[model samples]
Target chain A: MTDVVVAGGGLIGLAVAWRAARRGLTVTVVDEAPGRGASEAAAGMLAPVTEAGYREESLLRLGLASLERWPAFAAELEAAGGLPVGLRTVGTLVVGFDDDDMRQLEALHDFQQELGLSAARLLPRAARRREPSLTSRIRGGLLVAGDHSVDGRAVHAALLAAAEAAGVTLVRDRVEGVVVDGGRATGLRLRSGGTVPAGSVVVALGAHSAGLPGLPPVPVRPVKGQILRMAGAAGLLDGTVRALVRGRHVYLVPYGEDRLIIGATTEDRGFDPTVTAGGVHDLLHDAIEVVPGVSELELAETLARWRPGTPDNAPLLGPTAVPGLVLATGHHRNGVLLTPVTADAIADLLATGELPDRAAPFTVDRFEAP
Target chain B: MTDVVVAGGGLIGLAVAWRAARRGLTVTVVDEAPGRGASEAAAGMLAPVTEAGYREESLLRLGLASLERWPAFAAELEAAGGLPVGLRTVGTLVVGFDDDDMRQLEALHDFQQELGLSAARLLPRAARRREPSLTSRIRGGLLVAGDHSVDGRAVHAALLAAAEAAGVTLVRDRVEGVVVDGGRATGLRLRSGGTVPAGSVVVALGAHSAGLPGLPPVPVRPVKGQILRMAGAAGLLDGTVRALVRGRHVYLVPYGEDRLIIGATTEDRGFDPTVTAGGVHDLLHDAIEVVPGVSELELAETLARWRPGTPDNAPLLGPTAVPGLVLATGHHRNGVLLTPVTADAIADLLATGELPDRAAPFTVDRFEAP
Candidate 1:
């Protein structure tokens, strides 16, 4: 019998195992593919300012905190795992092609200022000079030197190593259900007809952490994001460039040895991992528009993966109403960014029976019972 | 007698003198201060895409043509003037912080693509990653990587040196008026009561090109632009950053030994050259919003200069009703970008007695008679 039986093997579950095992807990993480899920295809942008929206201030705060914790987390993860997570602090440059984009950027800047955050405005020339590959038609830009990125693959690899190094067991199999005792989750049942007993159950199964038999339904839906990887000469791009191009959100993330990630097409189709040609075409078209240098890079792979998203776009980080059953799913697009904070929250809860204040707004109680 | 007697020794006048001199014509340029017009305070952006509008296709074509001519023009000016003009083809990045700005930028991109001009869309992360100082609040951006800028003061100095090297005579005095001879305009009268005899008269007086005695009302008026010169370490900004912050056209130009030119608050106060504190405060406030690094730079000087603007916002170039009195003024915000083209048109007219096709649409005859 283990102290904690985690039902997932993605970044969240692995991170939980790593954190909990470091705290002297006997933790076991189960998943069909440990490094799969959205983590395999995400361009981990730890951006609070660019990703902030009108009413998502809580998410912004959480993201910012996670971003702040990333440096120390990565350092510790590397020391523990003996693997480096590709983290780059090259910053971000938000460029506009015309007056309308500039106006929206100004409004965003004003909102940022109102929220007491610092955002720098750049005239067109300054922006282009920084990124020479940027088109000349851009009107102006804003600079957020603090927004950084990490290599998701490296992070996942590091998490795996760290979890292994910390004495957490990884079971490469699908989680069938949670073993319940007196209507409270006690452990996980593997698909191989094996039951693993534990002192507490933690479900960090990402998009699959929903509608298990006799378990409370978590309202996280599968959001399919198609991403493209390109191998290029080093220095094709500096950091990441995100744009709302014709009302569509697109970005280019550069990480590792000249590995460029041009992604991602978001679709509402559930449980689908189809890499549509239209998705690839649109990504390449927009990618070439922003950074013409992308065309010169080699096409590596097109990956389609599922992210678990909640209705309000925030993750459920703390415990559920079911006794001994803690939840850490529905991170959606921010799972990579929220990895550090989520690990801390779940570890603290398992070690000390309490969730931190940062995890308060992200509790599973926000949603109606199903 | 000189073949061309040019009034107003700004960039346009000096460029025309240099071009005409290169074409083996005896050119004389007269002005009270050769580098004291709008050229002294212009952020010489060679942007056809950003400056082009719905009904301003003709100006766009002219600007694009001038942009095409700039590389060779700069090269020739460099060889002739023995000075660097700082023509940086750093391109332009247009960024938006909110939805409104992105929508406007989309419309502009659609319009540009409709006109067969290329504009690329960028996501916010990509933009911020390229420019580190940019705020993450920016929503998205467009890339016009072809648009560029030059050091205006350097261009002016190079133009002066080029004109002098090309054997064009420079008279340091104000022209009283264009001396009309039998309705065919022959020469200019100096303010010191001296008559300058010439084969043809070219009025290149920016902002002050109209309402002189013995000359027809040219329908040009003075638009005062207040600018700030900040002395800082070099590379504070990459190129130029232009913003229509709350619908006001503002920009920052980086040139000359860590000099940043925050400039030219547009006003319709009719030749008022007072550098108001409100203007400087607003400029500094807005400049810091985009590039937080601007706050650390030292304020060197405040400059206010007048630009000659016409009703339709296009320059009055080439021929007027009076045969020998060619018109070359009313270039408002585009004098720096249009300098090369204007020089060619005026020089071609002075040398071969015909205006080029590119300058045909911007002739003085388009205006109503005064």
Candidate 2:
């Protein structure tokens, strides 16, 4: 029997398992193929200020809180795992091409200012000065100097290593369902006709959370996203460039020496993993429109994955009505952004049996009756 | 000792070896990795009439001669190899998008008419009737009912099987250079520190022909090309759509049920094999401009290879200046189209020491100073 068993081995599940095991708890993570889900496709943009919305202030605060803990978390994890997490604090530039896009950026900038976030609006020339690879056709932009990014794949890898180092048992098999007895969550039923008995179970299956048996209704839905990874762009840009070409949104994040992460298209087409040509064309079209030099880089890879979207695009991060079963999935596009905070809060709950004050508002019960 | 040793196991070499073996000559082929060069990247367009130019009448005649042999060649090869060659004779449509493109199409049509080729100029509506997926923005087009195509990879596979089945020895070793003694080519020195002795040697190394030692200057240069293969394009186009978008040229060839071959860019950058972003962007942009539905297909693959180019853009067939050293390279963009004729002509020459009348004009001695 384990002190805690995690149903998925993605970044979220592995992070929670590692943190909990470090706090003197026996942990087990069960996944057929860990980190091959949304964790593998993330661009790792941790831009809470630039990505903040009007009515989602609490989510914004949560993102800011998570962003605040990233540096320390990355340092500790690097020490524990002996691997680099590829964290960069070079900031992000959000630019707009046309009048409508400019108005949208202005509105977002005003909102960021009202929230007292650290962002500066820039004209086309100023934006181009900040990042010379940007074309001169840009109208205006907003530079969020505090919003940084990390490499998502690297973080997942480091988490796996750290969890293994922390003595977290990794079960390379699928979790078919949660084993419940007497109206309390007890263990996980494995696909290989076995069961993992645990004091608690953390369901962090991301988009698959909605379909898992023996779990209550999770309002999570699979939102498909198509993205491209390009190489041979050694000096194309200094940092991340989020742009609105006409009315569509696209972002280019420079990673490593010659790699650029160009993404992505959010489609509501339910778990379809085909990287469509239109998705690639729209991404490249807008990316090239904002930065013409993008056309000269090599398109190294194209991928499609699902983001576990909630009704309000905020993650569910606390205990559910089921007693021993906790919910830690539905980070959506911000799984990489919110990794540190989610791990700390979930591991803290497992240790102290109480959800943290900052994480209380995001409980799954908020979506249930009153 | 073998009767013949061919250096290079590409479509040209394998086809020659297969045909010569069928004519009672023991043959051996030497290559490091067979059919992974320009043969794998060829778009397989046999469009001699639609691709006709002002000064390349002899090349056009040679293309027509090979085109005439394709049906019988494909049938016999399929019978010998037990594989489909994906040969489609549904013809091709040469389309134009803008005024300059329309003028160029009209000039090409005039030249084809002067040469008494079978081609008809069509209005945009009539062109759309042939390939309904073509965009309505097309200005005009030329319908060449004789132009055809084959799947290059499928042809390579079939040729491999046919060559193997015909008892031609396949040596999976790189050819270092020709082996010459007493002023006559004897065999080939291999990269594996071994040699393949033969009665005669055939130099069919494509772009690498110029770099082989112990052989005279072959006048071949590498012309780099980048191409893409896309899937999920079932029923997108009937045959092939060769379009002149603005001043640039692009082509889309359909293979199987759901795969489309979109190509390409011609650059003189030697042997650089990186598939540039500009090349992909231009291809997708022009393909979408010609057929809007192209944007919805999946980009299955991207590849870069080099074509063996000559001064006159015609092949250097028959014997070279070196005795017992025959030449069958420099097919350029027309290797797949000229495969059958090249095989037959070279095999005929090997059986009897006389170059055919049609193939005699393309000898390497033509490039020698008078």
Going through the candidates in order, state the TM-score of chain A alone for each one: 0.97, 0.99
- Give model 1's DockQ, 2 decimals: 0.01
**Candidate 2 residues B68-173, lDDT tens each?**
9999999999999999999999999999989999999989998999999999989999999999999999999999999999998999999999999999999999
> Number of clashing pairs, model 1?
65
The lDDT of each candidate is 0.83, 0.93
List interface RMSDs for the candidates, in order. 23.0, 1.3
- Candidate 1 segments whose C-alpha is farther than 4 A from its true place: B1-370
Best by DockQ: 2
DockQ of each candidate relative to the true complex: 0.01, 0.71
Error of 2 at A109 (Å): 1.1
Candidate with maximal TM-score: 2
Candidate 1 docking category?
A: incorrect
